[model samples]
Target: SQLSFINVQNRGNFRWPYDGLYQDEDGTLSGVVGGIVLSPDGLWSTSTTCTQTPNFLNAKTCPSSVGRWVRYAFNNANLAPNGEALFIYDTSNHYTIVLNLKKRLTHPDGYMMDLLTRQSYLFQFNGANSSVNLSYTGVVYDLVPGDYLIIRHNIDYIPDRVYTTSSSILAASSNTPLTAT
Candidate 1:
C-alpha cells in the first residue's frame, strides 16, 4: 500500500524506533537533540571532521555522538581516510573490503587484501550482506557508504588467506585502494 499523509488528530500507535523520541515520559527526555545508537554490540568510529552536540539521553551509553550523526546525516565517507578510525567491537563476521584497482589482487572477484602473507585476508562479513550493494569509483580515499557497498569481511570465508598488511593500511585501503602501502 502506498503511504499518504493524513491529518489525523492523533498518531496513537506510531512509536519511534529510538527511546527518547516522540515522547517525554522520562523527566530528562525533553528539549534534547541528536543521539547515537551503537547496536547491541557494534564498533564505534570517530572522525576529526565531526562537530555537533549529542543528545543528553544517550550521551553516556552511545559510543559515538557527533560522528554518528555526521555519518548518518551524510553517509560515511569512503573516498579518503580520516584523522581517526576507532573500532571498538570485535565480531567474528566483520571484515574490511576494498575496491579492486588495476586488477592486481587475487580473488578473481578483486578480493585483494592489504597484505598477501597472512593465513587469511578476508574479514568477517557482518549480518547485513543481503541488503548491501557495492560500487567501484576507482579510488578509496573518500568513499561514501551507501551505494550499498558493504565492506564486511568474514574470516570464515577466506580461511586459507592471511592479511599481509597491518590494520592501519587495511583501514586506509578501505577508503582508497590506490594509496595503500
Candidate 2:
C-alpha cells in the first residue's frame, strides 16, 4: 500500500501532534492572523502588537499610546509551544484553543465564542461573567478576552515533521473535548 503522509507516524507509534505555527511565515494559525490580543485595560486587537487604543473611559487614547492587549493564541510549537498551544501547566495534552499567558487572573472573553464564533473577540457574550480561564479552574479559563484561534483541520494530511512547512490542528479536533466551560 502507498502512504499519503510518509512521516505521519513516529517510531513510538503515535501520530505526531499538529503544529499551528507552520501556517505562515510569521507563525500564526490558519486564516487567523496575529491571534487576537487583549489590552491591559480591556480592549481587543487583531494582533499581539497593539495598533488600537483601549480607552475604557471618555479618555479617548491614541491607538498606539493607549493600553494594549495581553495577547493570546492556540500555540504551534517552539522550545515547548510558548504562545501557540494550550495545556495543563506543561502537559503534552494540548487543548484546541488556549491563552498565551499563564498563571494570571486575566482571561479571554466568554465561552460562547469557542463554540459559536470559533473566535474569542468576534462575539460579545451576555452578563459580566463572560470570562474564561486558560487553566483548568472554575469559571477561570486559560484564555483571555483577546485570545485568538480558528479550528482548521487542513494539517490532517500532514505526513511528517515538516516543521518548516506543516501545521497542527490547534486542539480543535473532535477527538478531544475542546471547551472552556
Candidate 3:
C-alpha cells in the first residue's frame, strides 16, 4: 500500500496567527499586523448555562460563558493586514500574533475587520456584567456599525523573539492550544 500526505487547508476565513510586518506590493514595510492585546480587566461570569471553551477546541461551541470581549478596529483601506494607521511597534520589526483565550475581566462583544483581506472576525464575551463600551472599545458587532477588524499594536521596543505561526488542527492532528501572550 502506498501512503500519501494530504495538504490540509483552513475551513473558514480564519486568519493565520503571526506577529510581523506586512509589506506592500512594492515590498515596502507596511508595518505590523494582527496584534491583539487581551486586557485582564472585568471578570468572567459563573453561569451554569455558560461554559468557556478552551482555545484548543476551536470548533466546539459553548454556552457563551466566556465573559467580556475586546475589540481593535482598523481602517478599510486597500492596504496590508498591518498597514498604516494600525499597530506599528518597536524598531526590531518583529511581532507575534496571538489569540489568548482565558477567564479574564469584562469585555464587550465586538468584531475586528481586516482591511487588507476585507475579512471580519466576530468575538463575544459572556460576562455577568459585560457591556459594550462603544467609545473606548470600538464598535460592537450587534450594532453592525461597519465592516472592520482591530489588531492593536503598541510597543516601544521589539522583543528578542516574535511568534509568527503555530500548529493548527489542520497541520497537527492533535489539539494544539492557540492563545495570545
Query: Which prediction has the highest TM-score against the true structure?
Result: 1
Estimate the overall C-alpha local distance difference test score of candidate 1.
0.25
Which stretches in model 1 have alpha-carbon errors above 4 Å?
A: 1-32, 44-65, 69-122, 125-181
Q: Write the per-residue lDDT of candidate 2 for residues 118-167, one digit (tens) a residue.
A: 23323211221223312221221233464433333222233232211113
* Alpha carbon deviation, residue 117, candidate 1 (Å): 30
**Against the hidden reference, what TM-scores do the models get?**
0.20, 0.19, 0.19
Q: Give me candidate 3's TM-score against the actual structure.
A: 0.19
The deviation in Å at residue 102 for candidate 1 is: 36
**Model 1: number of clashes?**
31
Candidate 2 global CA lDDT score: 0.25
- Residue 40, model 2, lDDT: 22
**lDDT per residue, candidate 3, 1-181, as tens digits?**
1222245232122133221112222211111122221211112122233233223112211121222223333222322233222222212333222222222122322123312212222222222111222112332222233322333332234333333222222342322323232
